[model samples]
Target: MARRALLTDRERELIEGGGDTDDELRYQAVSRVRRKIQEELTEDIDILRENHPDLYAELREVVCESN
Candidate 1:
């Protein structure tokens, strides 16, 4: 079993709230939120690889990483 990344309504609120103030603060907050989302996406990919090895291999061959 793998750890799941679950984003709740409260978590969404917190992420959104981080952008309410000054531009610098909002930029930092948005960056943090983006990092968190990327982490979660990676975790999800890991779990898929573990549970569906063949599919994962196929996906890896077909998908390209973005900048």
Candidate 2:
């Protein structure tokens, strides 16, 4: 099977385990989701990332985290 591009549980755990502040953790999570969304959802992530923060976040949370 093709490796799923969506963030995996292990990836999330490792990222969470890292000694980072809340802001840093949130950044990492969003960044990871954005990258995965770009891979599977759209190439023009800049548009969404810049113009639609709420949509961008929802997509990342609903789609990227539920693999």
Task: Evaluate model 1: give its lDDT.
Answer: 0.65
How many backbone clashes are present in model 1? 0
**Model 1: per-residue lDDT, tens digit, 1-67?**
6443344454445556654546665566667668776887678679889999887877677666533
| Error in Å for residue 35 of model 1 | 1.0
Best-fitting candidate, scored by TM-score: 1
Off by more than 4 A, model 2: 1-42
Per-model TM against the reference: 0.37, 0.33
RMSD, one per candidate, in order:
7.2, 9.3
Query: In candidate 2, what are the lDDT values of residues 1-67, reduced to their tens digit?
Result: 5475456765566556655536666677778777777675675455678899987887779767996
Cα lDDT for residue 60, candidate 2:
74
- Looking at model 1, residue 47 earns an lDDT score of 86
Q: In candidate 1, how many Å is residue 41 off?
A: 3.1
